[model samples]
Target chain A: MRVLGVDPGLTRCGIGVVDGQPGRPISLVDVFVVRTPPTDDIGARLLGVERELERMLATHRPDAVAVERVFSQHNVRTVMGTAQAGAVAIVAAARHGIPVALHTPSEVKAAVTGSGRADKDQVGVMVTRLLRLDAMPKPADAADALALAICHLWRGAANARLSAAAAKVPVSRLPKGSAQKGWR
Target chain B: MRVLGVDPGLTRCGIGVVDGQPGRPISLVDVFVVRTPPTDDIGARLLGVERELERMLATHRPDAVAVERVFSQHNVRTVMGTAQAGAVAIVAAARHGIPVALHTPSEVKAAVTGSGRADKDQVGVMVTRLLRLDAMPKPADAADALALAICHLWRGAANARLSAAAAKVPVSRLPKGSAQKGWR
Candidate 1:
């Protein structure tokens, strides 16, 4: 399934599209960034992001959208801006009837580099190799977006399989203690 | 000026509209909440907020929008959702060319109750008295939103006067020592 990954930010938001599924080679479809002037009013800045994301959703038509979830940050202002930008992306996808997934930064790193603690350079290198790009995507946000899409493609497909498998299992076959274990 | 104030949240976003100027007594136009089910997907929840806020903006056609600036919270998830909801309100206002202002929780409380650290009950009581309502607005969110609009009406008017006064001052006429002080 095709996936659109967004690294949301107020000044610059990254958007990348990747086509692939579990056990299949992934290919990069497109990558770009939408930027707003820092001096602009907050409302105008948000509207710019919303409109650009809406345009991208209409142009790409990805099967699913993956957004980098805003976690805690040293700067509360930055966290708020990121969350707002992320919300615009989420709402854009929802308007298009595209399922959206939120991936933590560490989760995206782990999926791309096999290390949750991997740094930006490691993520960039791995994303380049995974997508078979001639060079690294400029503006670290672009590489990060690609990594997010790759993560969703790999993880989402696996999740779907697990869900399908669980659905096919007969209720009578469930282990006596399975209910207590809880599905994580 | 008519002002629309928003207290944004994922489950329930409070919206209130008030009409008046800085010195004049403010009158409440309307107050209500838009709610989304917790069980819904995050994308769907965000979309619900965006659409509702848009509809409110269209119906009210307020001169300005005031949003409660989401502050840091112990729960990261809650903060993100609040920030996202606030962004939707800001964008909806922006789309209609209505200037948007952000007021911190403490600012709203102080404006309504004369105490930045006032409790919820104090805020609700002051808001009801300020609006000259027979009873308090149901749900603390509704009162909070009304307080936010009141804050914006009073504060925004004062801000405009300050800006206008500053604009009238000529830099060249300032005292030599003023250059070192810098313009605030």
Candidate 2:
């Protein structure tokens, strides 16, 4: 399965595409960033984000899209930025008909670095190692996007395996609430 | 000057247009809301925002756009929504090459109600009185957008007067560092 991950922002957005197949490790297909000029009208900047996302979808054609869920602290300005980024990602994924999944920053960090408290650099290094990249991703946003994609890949595989196992087992033999209990 | 005000959101965006002329009260040209499907792709939804914004701009030919700045709070999900809405507003204005202005929720409220801490209902009531609307603008988002435009009109005019006054003031009369402190 091909997964496209996004780290959304108003001024700049980071995008990463990863491919995963049965019995093969997830591979980074592409990574890039889209930016909106500060001097441009806000409406135009949103259009730029939309257009860039459309272009990415057409070019990469990933099976799924993964994005970071919003996490806010005390700063209202930062919260606003986080919300704007989340909205853009949601709008982009909804337009394409590709299933979209949201992962928290902590979840992604843990999946990539084996620690939920991992810093951006640590996550970047782990993502580089996991994807076998020659070097770490340049911008921290790109690295976060990659980590989000990796988290999805790992969780998605686990979900698929559990689904398959359930399919083979008789309904009576399965433990109660087993379906609801795993990998949400 | 004609100004378009936007209240952006994932599911619905509120838009209001106002015409501002010298020595006359601001006139409400039009008001409407745009809705997007929740399940649609993110790209398509953003396109929807773009298309709706373009239609508003084409119909009204606004000279400027006014938008609310995002405020972060304790809720991550709410912050995400605000961010998305802000981005959509920014992109819409940018696409048309129209100058854009941002106002905080408190600033807009203060302009309309003389109190930055005023609640939405108070602001709505004040907007109705200020614009002489037949009824309070329906939908909180629509009212908020109208208030944004009103806030811009009030502040923009004040800013212009301040600038003109500063331009005429003699440098010799001003205290050292006073120029930098004036109307920044």
Candidate 3:
């Protein structure tokens, strides 16, 4: 399934679309950032970001959207902006009837790089290699968005399979050791 | 000027509209809360809030919208939801071409009760008194929304006047005492 990922912030919001399914190679469809002017009114700035997100949702038509969840632990001032930006992106996807999945920064890193503590450069390297891009996506936000989409493709697909397997089997009647294999 | 004030939260977002000019009796036009279920997806929750805000804007057609500014210093987890909810309100107002104003909690309290640190009960009592209502508005969020609108009516009007006067005056020509009065 195709997935769209958004790395949201006040100054610049990253949007990326990737097409792939579980156990298959992923390909990049598009990546870009939407930047809002700081001098504009707070409401207008947010409205600008929302408009861009709506446009992206219409243009890409992804099966699902993944957003990087905001944590309030770092950057006290920008935390509010990041949360607000992410909210607009989530709402845009919902309006289009596309399900949205949120992955924390570390979750995205771990899913793509196998390490929750992986730095931005490591995540960027993996995203580039996975997508087979000639160059890494510019402006860390854009690359981060791609990593998020990649994470959703793998994790979402795996979870779906597990659910399907669980639905078909009764725990008591299941064969020995089947549960572990099914969940895996 | 007509103003719609929004007190935004995750579970319930308060929307209140009032009509009045500077130094005049403010009358309530409408008040209500949009409630979103926590069980719903995050995107769906935000979309629910946005849809209600759109309806309010369409119904009231207020000249301006006021939202309580969310701060990160308090309620670490809920702060993100509050910011997201408030962001949607701001974007909705902007979409309707309504100027948006934001007031801090302390600003609202000070405007209504002459004390920045006033408690919720004090703010609610003052809101009821100022609106000349027989009973206070139910739900503390609803009352706070009204207080935000009242704050905008007073502060927004004063700022507008200051801008208009500043535009017409040559600062050098103003008398010493007149300058002080003009600002106040």
Candidate 4:
């Protein structure tokens, strides 16, 4: 399964794509970041995001998309930022007909670092280790996105197995190419 | 002078255009609403907003654009909504090279109702009376947007007068049309 994970923001967004099978190690297929100038018009900024996402979708063709769910707090300005970023990511996935799964920050952290309360640095360290990377993912947002993808991979596998077991039928009874469905 | 006002939203956006100068009563040149289905792709939704705004701009050839300024708040989801809406409006204005001005809700309310704390119903009633219309404007968003435009005109005129007064320096030392040049 190939999963595209996105960390959305108005000024900067990070995208990561990973490919792997359900019980096997996931491999990073590609990773990149997009940045928009603060002075640019809002339309131009959104266009930049759309163009980059379109290119990533075309090139990687990930089967599913995972995005960080935004939760607003007291700061109206921060809330606006989170909302714009979330909207952009959601729109990008929706545009491609990709089923999107939104994960909370804690869920992502727990999946990647084995602790829901893990800090950014902890999550980054664990993600690098789990992915067997040469170093920690640069720019915390990219690492967070990758961790989100890894979380999906792990959860997806668990869900698939549970689904197969609950069906009270052999796993082979499922669709023949179902394993390939999640990956583009 | 003509002013176009936009109220941006995820599923539906409202638009209104008015023509007139400050102090003198403004006329409702046009008022309409545009909508995008939730199921539509983000790009398509944006395109819809763009197309509608462009059509209005072309048909009316407004001299200025007025948009609602998003207020920062603690609610992430609400902020996101406002930001997305704001982005669409900003993009539309920028695309046509129109001079865009953002007005706060309170400012618009005060301009239309003579009280910054006016509620929507009060504002609507005041708008009707101010425009000498027979009935309240339809579609609350559109009415609010129109009020925003009216607010801009009122403020713009006051600003113009202030600039003119400030420019009454030694006439010989002043550049011709300097005040007008700055306004433009």
Candidate 5:
């Protein structure tokens, strides 16, 4: 399956496309960053991100989209921007009926470098080696995005299979469980 | 000028539309809430918000859109959802080429009531009186939304004029002054 991964940001959003499935050699199809002028209105900036993402989705036609889930940061302003950018990416994918998965930074790091706390340099190196690229992706954001896609490919494929399996079980045969409770 | 005001939330987003400019008697055009189930996928929930806001924009054809600016809260999860919802509203308005403004919660309360720290009941009472409604709007979210619309009519109109005035002043004609160096 092909996956488009987005590292969402207000000033520079990174996009990467990879073609592969779990336990397979993933090939990098493309990678780019969409930057909006910092001086622009917030609404305009968000719209620019959304439009660029929509364009990428149309062109790449990825089966799924992976986005870096926004986590709380010491800088509230930065976190807010990241969250807004991520939200736009999610909406863009959903509008196109593309399955979207959110991977935490640690999860991406672990999936790529086998270390949850891997630094950017380590993640970049591992991504380069895994994708068999001659050179590492430029701008840490781009590498991070590729890492997200790779993580989703490894994790989301298995997740889909599990979900399908669960769906097959009849309700009467379902195990007793607590009601799902959590904000999306 | 007509304005659509949004009180952004993930589960229950409040929307209100009003028609008037500063110093004029504003009339309520419409008010409602858009809700997404908590159990829905985050991406799908965000898209639902975007679609609902888009529909409201098309129906109201408001000159501008006003959204309650999300503020930092103790609860990170809650704040993230609020910010995401607000981003959707802002993007919807931008897509339609409508000007968008953000008002702080305190600012909305102050505009609708005499005090910035007024309680919800006071804000609701004032909104009912200002809109000349037979009774207060149901659900506090609905009333809060109408209050936002009233606040925008009172504050955003003046702010727009000031912006227009500033834009008209060419840089060469601008008074020699301190460089712009602070948030609005």
Candidate 6:
């Protein structure tokens, strides 16, 4: 599956595209940052980000989009901008009927580096190793975005497998006291 | 000037359109709320709000758009939704080349009810009277939207007048302590 991961921010939104499935090596399709002028009107800045993301969505045509779920940051203004940028990414994916998933910073870190509390350097190193890249993706945002895409690939693939396995099981063969009766 | 005012929210986004200029009677063009199902995906919800806003912008063809500036509310989730909705409205206006202005809640209240601390009821009553409507706009959001529109009309007109007056002033007539020297 192809997944486009976004580290949404008004100043420099990181974009990373990865192709992978569960238990497989992920390949980097594309990586870049979408930046808008800081001096521009807030509306214009958002529009700029949205336009770039829309173009990426059309260009990459990923199966799913993963966005960093913005949490409360030190500065309210900064957090607001982050949240708005993330919202734009989500809407862009929804417009194209592509599924969108949000991963928290910790989740992405844990998924990529096996440590939820991993620092930027660790995450970047792990991403570089996993993608077999000669050099790590520069800028923390870029590495974080790749982590998000990788996280979604593993998590979503696992969930899909679980669902499929459950579907294949016969209801009559279910053990007693199972919650399967609720399915009726 | 024609203005579209939005009181942004996820559950119910209030929209109000008005037409008026400085020192003129403001006329209400339309007022309504755009709602999205709460159970819907966040991306779909934002898209729904954006669609309604775009339609309104096209139909009304407003010269300017006024949106409420969201601040931190009691609920962080609610505030995030409000901010996202507001961002969508701003983007819609920007796409159409319409100038967008943000008015704080207190500013809206003060512009309509002569008191920044006025309650919803006071603002509602003032909006009803100002628009010469028999009934107050239902739901606090609707009234707040109209107040935003009215606030924009008056404040923008005043600012324009100030700019025009400043332009009309000759350099020779400027005071020695005036900041116009820096402006030049």
Fraction of true inter-chain Cα contacts (below 8 Å) kept per model? Answer: 0.63, 0.53, 0.61, 0.23, 0.49, 0.39
Q: Across residues B1-184, which tens digit of lDDT does each residue of candidate 2 receive?
A: 8889887665777889888775688788998877777666455656687678789988998888887776565355554555666676675566667777888789899998999999999998997887889899988888888889888888888878877898888878767876421100
Write the residue-wise lDDT of candidate 4 on B1-184 in tens digits. Answer: 9999887665667788988875577898888777877665444565566568779988998888887777655344444555666665665565567777777889899998889999999988887887778899877887887898889889888877877787776767667765332100
lDDT of 6 by residue, A63-155 (tens): 999998766644777877887788888878988999888888888898988989999999999999999999999887888888899999998
Give the docking tier of candidate 5. Answer: medium
- Docking tier of model 1: it is acceptable
Candidate 6 interface RMSD, angstroms, 1 decimal: 8.0
Residue pairs of candidate 1 with colliding backbone atoms? none
Q: After superposition, how far is residue B29 of candidate 6 from its true place, in Å?
A: 0.6
Report the poorest 10 consecutive residues by lDDT, candidate 4 chain A: A175-184
Writing each residue's lDDT as its tens digit, candidate 4 over A1-184 gives 8998888765777888888787678788888778877666555665677678779989999888887776665455555555565556665666577777777789899988889999999998987887889998889888988888888888777877877775787667877755331100
DockQ-sorted candidate list, best first = 5, 1, 3, 2, 6, 4
C-alpha lDDT values of all predictions = 0.85, 0.76, 0.86, 0.74, 0.85, 0.85
Error of 4 at B116 (Å): 1.1
The numbered model that scores best in lDDT is: 3
Q: Give the TM-scores of the predictions, in the order they appear.
A: 0.91, 0.78, 0.90, 0.72, 0.90, 0.88
Best by DockQ: 5
Deviation (Å) of A183 in candidate 1: 18
DockQ each candidate and list the results. Answer: 0.44, 0.30, 0.37, 0.17, 0.50, 0.29
Interface RMSD, in order shown: 5.9, 6.5, 7.7, 7.9, 2.7, 8.0
Clashes within 3 Å, all models in order: 0, 33, 0, 8, 0, 0
Query: Candidate 6: which stretches are off by over 4 Å?
Result: A161-184, B164-184
RMSD of each: 4.4, 5.2, 5.8, 7.9, 3.5, 5.8
Which is the better candidate, 5 or 6, if ranked by lDDT? 5
Query: Which tens-of-lDDT digit does each residue in B83-163 have in candidate 6?
Result: 888888887787788888888889898899899999999999999999999899988888888889999999888778777
Give one digit per residue, the lDDT tens place, for model 3 in B40-155: 77777888889988988899899999999877888776888888888888878878889888888998999999999999999999999999999999899899999999999998
Q: A48, model 6: CA deviation in Å?
A: 1.0
Worst 10 residues of 2 chain B by lDDT: B175-184
- Comparing candidate 1 with candidate 6, which one achieves the higher TM-score? 1
DockQ of 5: 0.50
Worst 10 residues of 6 chain A by lDDT: A175-184
